[model samples]
Target: MFTLIAAMDENRLIGTGRGGLPWSGITRDKQHFRDYTAGKSLLIGRRTFEEMRGWFRREDRPIVMTRNPDYDPGGHCRVAGDLDDVLALAADSDGEEIVVCGGAELYRLTLPFADRLVLTLLHADFPAREGGVFFPEWENEDFVELRREDFAADNQASPSMTFLYLARRAGSEHADC
Candidate 1:
């Protein structure tokens, strides 16, 4: 199974486009991400993988997607040259879920093949940075909400969040990956 997981604000602001998140320090959201991705093979873009350097666990298998054939992520993770390679990895996952963790491009590239989407929606907004990265546009008709959990902000500094889980609707059309 392929699952696309991410957290975005009301404006869908996900990244600074310079290898950072627009918002940070939400303990609940971080925990939510870790819980969903644990034990899953991760399909991440090169930039996103680099931004997450040293944050992976020994059991977390990551396949970094990049166009550079010689790019190595220092043996901590493997690399995939393109979407074809990513698809093959997913094909061989057996029953293991392959989580599509992102930079925007990777999410846009893998969204079509996602069996499920696990998203964290923050009840707040942040200014869009110059060259900011936003989550790719998706149609709600293509998926059905399976679950949701709402969490109020921990303090005045944090934003309230909603953990949402959705599965691709039966008969929904998806492009072959």
Candidate 2:
């Protein structure tokens, strides 16, 4: 199954830059990603791919979707010019699974295609901006809660944040909210 796991906030700010900006000040979310994605295929945008470039490869690649035809694979990985291509390649992979690690725009685009979501809902987003570049929101009936994990008490710096694993229901459209 195709899965997308993200660490975001209640205000829904997924990221501002690349690797350097994730909510890594917290550790449980980090461990969840590591444990979940260590040996799986990951799908990402060019910027996200570049951010984690040195750490991944074409063979163990996190696939990148881009418009630049000149885009280089750099290794045994794959690149797609559009969503159809991304979905096709992911579905055809021997493992039949893909995980998305992102910058928010990609999340917005991928939500319609994803089957499962692993989210870390932070207590707050940026102060004034609050939320930026978020995926379309879905109602509670749209998903089934598979699990929830509380962050360590010491990390109350963002109290409302809670980690969640939700499976999107079949036949749903992730319309923009």
Best by lDDT: 1
Model 2 regions more than 4 Å off? 17-24, 57-59, 124-132, 155-161, 170-177
Q: Candidates' TM-scores? A: 0.94, 0.78
Give the Å shift of residue 4 in candidate 1: 0.4
Error of 2 at 88 (Å): 3.6
RMSD of each: 1.4, 3.8
Task: Encode model 2's per-residue lDDT on 74-148: one tens digit a residue.
Answer: 876789887667667876776567788876667777776767888877766554233345545757777889998
Candidate 1 vs. true structure, TM-score? 0.94
Predicted structure 1: lDDT: 0.86
| Clash count, one per candidate | 0, 2
lDDT of each: 0.86, 0.70
